[model samples]
Target: MLVRKMDSEVLVLATDNRGKIVELTDLLKPYHLRVLSTKDLLLPDPEETGSTFIANAKIKALTAAQASGIPAMADDSGFSVAALEAAPGIYSARWAGPQKDFNLAMQLVHYKMIISKSDDTQAWFTCALALAWPDGYCESVEGYVYGRVVWPPRGDNGFGYDSMFVPDGKNMETFGECNINRKKLISHRADAFSRLVNRCFKGRNFDGKRLLSFRQK
Candidate 1:
């Protein structure tokens, strides 16, 4: 049964990414913690205008915490394309276009490389998870997974750029080509969430706009 209480030691994850939710579900459950999503509260999502992944994650976390007056969490992450000089970094979502055309985004990347005559298809996935308390305190942890980009696409399992992301040493397929358990083992989001579990604890204090303070105690 869903509990209804303001002071409950709950975590409001500030994201709408279902893939991430699925990836993080198990890691969060062991704490016996109440996990809530923006969808559950019908909350408005904040605009991710931050220039960096950390900045964006923090923005969303604080927004949810402030909006719901509870401890909240968020993650902002994407792929860094080496050929494009790490471009489409913050633009990963937009690259898929306003309609989120994953196919077009994949084609665009391949086309860009094919035209450039550069096979530097090295890329990596990254995610930064931010946690914030009602008092305005916030903390964040990051995750990274190195991988290579594939051109023809691969198996269909994961979503958004996954079909074209092939991890190093395994030339078999893309992230979409791998199963959920396999994906979790080497995914960036998984790494970040793991860090959160290690260093994170309840209760903290707020510093200011530039930053906030969170402690193990």
Candidate 2:
């Protein structure tokens, strides 16, 4: 019958951070999907009780989905320290302190790593993304990017740990220095969101396959 159906997947950005919404909106915009901001709905940030990234993301996504009955999305991301044996792995965001001073946080890490440079100072940024559909079909995806830390807060492009992280091949620039599109290409959040959006928007399943090769399931 050549029947066509409209995509009802309204991606709800579950965050009060306008910068994050803008970054994520640009990433998801290619799908031509409707993206809603948390501020638009006056949704209060939910208490994050989950101990892990996926758990936290799921909590936010589920909360939004329950409230709006739309497919909602959330990201829980953080830094992990190799020298500390990953002590601050899940505590990255909280480590920013009352002032949200990532420079201080970077200093603390730099000191620790300098003393224990023998260890794999190799750190990774991890993002766990959750998608909550109105029909109760929820899915979670995770992405990780390995990199080493830089000092003195190089640039002003990105927020949080991006200032300290020099991703895999890049030499001089921190993630904060890289443009939004460049950051999106090799970011943890992008990896997870790529999986999620491909599945939901394109009716494809990525599984463990490359994003470009996503096939209809």
Q: Please provide TM-scores, in order, for all candidate models, with all chains considered together.
A: 0.85, 0.83
For residues 98-144, could you state the per-residue lDDT of candidate 2 as single tens digits? 78787777787888887876557677888888877666556778888
Alpha-carbon deviation at 130 in model 1, angstroms: 0.5
lDDT of 2 at 196: 67
lDDT of 1 by residue, 101-177 (tens): 88898888888878768778899988999987777777788899888888798877888889989888745668897
How high is the CA lDDT of each candidate model? 0.77, 0.74
* Per-residue lDDT of 119 in model 1: 75
Off by over 4 Å in 2: 1-6, 114-119, 204-216
User: Can you list the residue pairs that collide in candidate 2?
Assistant: 158-176
Which lDDT value does model 1 have at 153?
Answer: 86
Q: Considering every candidate listed, which one attains the maximal TM-score?
A: 1
C-alpha RMSD of each candidate structure in angstroms = 7.1, 6.0
The local lDDT score (0 to 100) that residue 65 gets in candidate 1 is 90
